[model samples]
Target: MTTVKVKLTHKNYDVKIEKGLHQAIGEQVRSVWQPRKVVLITDSNVGPLYLSSAQGQLEKAGFEVLPVEVPAGEASKSLTKVGEIISQMAQAGFTRQDGVISLGGGMVGDLSGVVASLYMRGIAFIQIATSLTAQVDSSVGGKTAVNLGETKNIAGTFYQPDLVLVDSDYLDTLTDRDLVEGYGEVAKTSALEGQDFFNFTGKIRSVQDIRDHAPELSERSIAYKAKVVMGDEKEAGQRQFLNFGHTFGHAIELLSHGSLRHGEAVAIGMVTVTRVFEAEGISPEGLTQALIDRLQAVGLPISSDLVGTPLFFQHMINDKKNRGGVINMVALAQVGQPIIVPKPLDEIRSMI
Candidate 1:
């Protein structure tokens, strides 16, 4: 088992990563949180697979568990779902002392975190990140959110979890497409982490390679994020690097409707935005192609027809990362060096 500690100004927590760690969820939770009634949130797809075992473990560890299941997918990340979960917790007689345990993937983790943050103002929550995306990116860093309408992660908060447990064993059941979606985020992180990690990720040409290096990938991604979060928790400065592909990615993601997964859109965003900056001579010549090679090596898409359209132009202007009237896009001077470049709305439209 490897533990990464996230130290913040108001709170600090540990992200624990290991194989088969799912089997010991109860003991791990008991070690950190006092005994209390906990709400275990899962989804349709994952409930049948591991919900019973997770509930049993938590029960054995002396926690009173209420298993709440929701539909599985991106659509579940909404205010309507958040309201329903909060209503369930209220009916169960939960308080700030009691906590929430997210037992599924990123959707469950993000949804549960938002619930925990809003319940009685705020309560404790544990992240048992099951999916690759959850384990690598969303489960750490304390950014809890739900998509508002078509805008992704529009309603959210920076609520840190009490503890995070990432079990790679849970990823074994994921579909090939799901693994590819997650590799998008992994590739993004590796690109921002510099040459050593990027080179390591460049060798991963298949899903089997990801399965082989799950623990190492999870550990390194969490460790790098912990370092960045410690320096800038609220995204006022350095933390924005984590949004390497997100600015334009979020725009294209909205435009893609349901066809594109978040990581897939981010894969496209990284390459597309890099291409624009490269043409402007801001980013180096090879940066865009490098991203394309690394992303395609893992079967992640690097471009989309939806990009450069009128709708795409409007969406980019409305991105949450933009401040005032300036559209801020994350650009790489090279691997490991990310910069935020602001552009005029007309300038952005011209690029499209």
Candidate 2:
């Protein structure tokens, strides 16, 4: 078991990475935020597998657990779904004194966190990430959002969780494709962080390796994220490093008509960023090749199907990170060092 404490200005939380830690939820919640009621928000796919265990634990802690299961996939992150879940909480007599527990993957965490943030202004929430992507990245961050049409995360808020509980055992039930999708983010982090983290992930060749290793890889990735986030909690400075591959990734996801998974699009986005870096004479030694190789090794796409530079540039302009009509892209100066370049629309169009 490994623990990383994330200290926010208002409150501090712990990200507990361990195997079979799901069973300790009752005690952990009691020790941290003691609430009379807990609304466990999960997706349809994950509800059947682990919902009972979480509910039982909360029940044992004398909590009135209201299990709300939404349909799985990205589509669930919508205003309609969020409203439905809030209504469920209302019918269950939920109040600010109560807390919400997200027990699936990124979709659950993001959607549930939004509910926790908006319901009665704000309330406590816990993250029980069941997927590699959520455990490593999305679940730890305070950013929670839902999509609005073609734009990604257009409706959202910064709502931090009270606790982040990562259980590696859930990876056992993940499909190979989902596991591969997760590696895209892990590889992107490697590109931004350094080769040592890349080397650490190289040992993870298969889903079994991820599960068998338990909290080691998960804890390390979370720690890397925490370090970056602590320095720039609002993404005002060095924290933008986390978006190394996300600019192009988010566009690809929008352009693909939701055909590509977030991680898969990010994999393609990382490749595009590398190409742009090379064209700009800013390519790092062996970095581009290594990233390409690692992405391929993880079954992620190295290139995108969309080829029109004009359309791509248009999407980049609408990016949330854009400031004063200039897109701020996070590019690699070297492994472990990221440079934020304020790119003009014309320059960005030419690069695409």
Candidate 3:
């Protein structure tokens, strides 16, 4: 078991990473939260697989578990779904002291976090991350949000979880593509952390290989992200490095009309941004190709056909990271070194 502590000004929580911890979640929750009406939110794909074990454990531990399942995909991260979850919690008489449990991947964690944040002003929440993307990225950070229209995570908050339970066993049910989708995040984190992580992931070629090394890979990734979150809880400074591939990634997500997965979009985003930076002579030469080789080795896209299109242009302009008519894209100084470069919209567009 690897326990990483995330210390913020408002609260501090532990990210518990252990294989097969899913069956013991009830006892774990009991340790941190008192018995209460705990609402567990999951998605279609995950609910049938592990929901019963998680819910049964919580119920056995005396928590009033209210299990809810959303459609499986990025579409569920919206105000409409959040309203439905809130309505259910309200009807069940949940209150400020009640807790929420996110029992699936990134969308589940993000939506559940926001619901917990808004319900009765605020409520305690726990993350039982079932996907690599959630365990390593979304679940650790205090960033909880619901996408609004074409904007991803446009409506959200920096609300920390009371506990994060990451059990790598959940990866067993994932399809090959699902595992590959997560490697994009693994790639991003490795790039920002250092060359050691970069090389570790570079050698992994298959999604099954990624799953084979889940526990250690997840523990390492979570710790790096936790360290960043601890230092910049609100994304005011150092935390932005965590968005290494996100600037253009979010735009790619919007332009895909929900076809591309988040991590996959970020994979191409990392490549796109690296290529742009290398062309501008800001990044060291071969940085783009080096990054591309690893991403492609894991079956992630290294470029997009929409890069110079009009829709891509519009979404990049509307990116959430933009401020005062300038956009900030995280560029790689090398495999493990990241730098944030702020540029005008036109300058960014010309690179694409």
Candidate 4:
């Protein structure tokens, strides 16, 4: 098992990475969560696979476990779903004293965390991430949210989980499409960390390959992300760099109408940013081609012809990173180092 401690200004928590930690969720979160009730939340897909084990573990640890299931997929991540879950918890007599156990991939983790934060002001939660995307990104950052009307994660909060347990075993159940989604975040972090790490990820082939590289990949991703998040937990400044591929990615995703997974969209978005910046002489020459090659090596999407529309740019203006009509686009000076480039919405629209 490997443990990385995230040190925030007001709170700190450990992101524990192990192969079988999902089976021990009750014991793992025991220290931080002394709960009157443990509300275990999972998505429809993952609930059947791991919920019972988590429930049994928590029950064995003497927690009164309550299970909640949300339909799987990005569409389930909505204000409506959040409201439903909150209402269910209220009916169950849950209070802030009862913690939440998020036991699935990114969607489940995001939805569960949102419910935990909103139920009775806020409550403790522990994330047992079952997907590569969640394990590497969403599970650790404490950035929780649900989509609002085609915009992704437009409503969320930064309420840290008590602890994070990442079990690589879950990657075994992912389909090729799901595998590609995981690589999206892996590629994003690799780009942000610099050329060597970016190149390192290019060699990975499948979920099993990722498992072999988990120690190195997970550590580097978490380190770069944690550094930025600790410096700016609320996205007030440096944290925006983690959005290196997110601004445009979000727009393309909305345009795709849930056809493209978040990471798939990010893959295209990163390529888009690289090309646009390179054309404007902001990034190095051939950067887009280089990213395309690496992204292709990992089976990620390089471009989306469907993203060519005025609606795409409209969504950019609505991005959370924009302020005062200026979009805070995260540009790579090269791979690894990021610079926030603010441009008027008109310039961004014209560039797109």
Candidate 5:
């Protein structure tokens, strides 16, 4: 097992990564938590596969486990769902002394973490990130959220988890689309980390390639992210680089009305933004094509049909990065050097 400790000013936690770690869920939680009631929050898709084993493990470890399964997908990341889960926990007589066990991918982790934070002013929660995206990105950052209207993660908080257990075994059951969707984050991180990491990810051409490299991939991304989050937990500064591909990506995603996955949209966002910046002489001339090639190598989309359209930029107007009518767009001077430039909304619109 490999462990990455996220040392934060407010708190510190460990992200344990290993295959077959799923079997140790109960024992692992027990090591960090006392015997108490826990709401095992999962989604419809993941519940049938791993919830019982996870619940049984927690139960065996002396936790009074109450299983709450929500319908799976992006729609589940909503205030309505958050309210429903909170109501369920309240009805179950849950308290801050209790905890939450998020069992699934990014959506489940995000939704579960939001509920745990809101319940009784906050409670302990652990993330068992099952998907490639969650394991590498969302699970480690302590950023929890739900979507409001068409915006992605517009509603969220930085509520750190007690622990994070990433077991790659659960990824075996994912569809090829689901598996490839995760590489979007891997690709985004590779870009932020620079040439070597970008070259490393460029070699990933198939699902088998991702599986072969999952451990190292998860470790490297999480490690880099932990370092970044430790320095800027609230996205006040350098941490904004992590949103390299997110601005345009989030807009394209909303425009698609959930047709595109988050990472898929990000893949497009990375390419789109880099091109716009390159055209404006902000990024290196060849950066966009390089991103296109690498992202395409992993079967990820590099451009969205909705892009360059009015609605696409319209969606971005609501981006969290907007301040005083200017968008703090993350641009790359090169593969390794990302900078945030506050561009006017009208200037961004000119790219279309």
Candidate 6:
């Protein structure tokens, strides 16, 4: 078991990553806070698979357990669902001392984190991430949010989790496509960090590689994010580098009308941004092609199926990252380096 500590301004926590670490959750929480009433928030798909085991463990530790399950999907990350979960927490007789445990993927982590953040002002929460995307990225940063309509993650807060428990065993139940979707983020992180990390992902040839090698990969991704979050916890500075491909990625997800997974769209977005950088004569030697090959090997799409420069440009304008009518983009000068460039719509349009 490897442990990484995230020290934020208002709070500090530890991210514990290992295979079969779920059983130790009760003991871990006890070490942080005295055993109090606990709430386990999960989605329908994950509820049957791992929820009961978590509940049983907490109950055995002498704490009352409340399990709340929402429908599984991106659609669940909404204001309405947030209200529903808050109401459920109240009905369960929760207190300020109780903590909420997010027991699924990113969706569960985001929504439940928000619930824990807002309930009775704020309560502690733990991330028991069961998916690759959540374990490596979403579960660590303290960025909790719900999607407002078509705009992704527009309504949210910076609520850090008290503990992040990742068990690679859960990846065994993930579909090939799901695993591929996660590799996109892992690849993007590798690209933003450097050749050593990028090359590590390049050698992966199967889903089992992701599971077998997750601890190291998870640690690397978490470490990269931790530095950014620690420096600019509020995203007012260098932290924006973490959104390397998300600007175009979020636009693509919006344009697809919710069909594309976040990481899949990000894969296409990274390729699009790199091509734009290449056209501008700013990309590094052999980097673009290598990144593209790595993404393809993991089954991520290199190009968008929907083609229309005008439509794509329109979607990019609506990104939350845009500031004062100018689109702020995080573009790569080379692997492991990201520079934020503000571009006019006409210039961005011409590239499409």
Error of 2 at 341 (Å): 1.2
- Give per-residue CA lDDT, model 6, range 6-97, as digits (tens): 88888888888788787787787777867888889999989999889889888888778889999999899999998998888899888898
lDDT winner between candidates 1 and 4:
1
lDDT of 5 by residue, 1-352 (tens): 8999999988889999999999999999998999999999899999999999999988998999999999988899999999998898889998879999899999999999999999999999899999999999999888999999878898999899989998889889999889889989998898888788888987887778998899889998998899899999998999999999898888888888878998999999988888888998999988888888877876888877898788877777788998877999899988878899898888887875
lDDT of 1 by residue, 1-352 (tens): 8999999999989999989898899889999998999999999989999999999999999999999999998899999999998998899899879999999888999999999999999998899998899999999988998998777888999999989999999989998778778888888898888899999988887778989998999998889989999999999998989998887788888888878888899999888888988999988998888878878877888889888888887786667876776777788888888888888777777885
Error (Å) of candidate 1 at residue 241 is 0.9
The residue pairs found clashing in candidate 2 are none
Which candidate gets the maximum lDDT versus the true structure?
Answer: 5
- Candidate 4 structure quality by residue, lDDT tens digits, 1-352: 8888889988999888777776777788776766468788898888888888888888888899889888888888998998998888888898767888898889999998899889989988888888778878988888999899967788998889889887777877877678668778988888888888888887876656776776577777877787778888988888888888888888888888878988999999999888999898888897788778767876788889766587887787778877879988888888777898998888876786
Stretches of candidate 4 off by over 4 Å are: 205-208
lDDT of 3 by residue, 165-264 (tens): 9998898888877878888998888888988988898788777779888887888898899888888888889888988888888888788886788888
Please give the CA lDDT of all the candidate structures. Answer: 0.88, 0.84, 0.87, 0.83, 0.90, 0.84
* Model 2 C-alpha lDDT versus the unseen true structure: 0.84
TM-score of candidate 6 versus the correct structure, residues matched by position: 0.96
RMSD per prediction, one decimal? Answer: 1.1, 1.6, 1.1, 1.5, 1.1, 1.5
Model 5 residue 126 distance off true place after TM-score fit, in angstroms: 0.6
Which stretches of candidate 5 lie above 4 Å from their native place? none
Lowest summed lDDT across 10 adjacent residues in model 1 is found at: 316-325
lDDT of 4 at 198: 83
Per-model TM against the reference: 0.97, 0.95, 0.98, 0.96, 0.98, 0.96
Residue by residue across 263-297, what tens digits does model 2's lDDT show? 99999888888778866878776677777877776
4 or 6: which has the higher lDDT?
Answer: 6
Error of 5 at 338 (Å): 1.0
Q: Can you give the lDDT of residue 266 in candidate 3? A: 95
Task: Give the lowest summed-lDDT range of ten residues in model 3.
Answer: 311-320
Candidate 6 regions off by >4 Å?
307-311
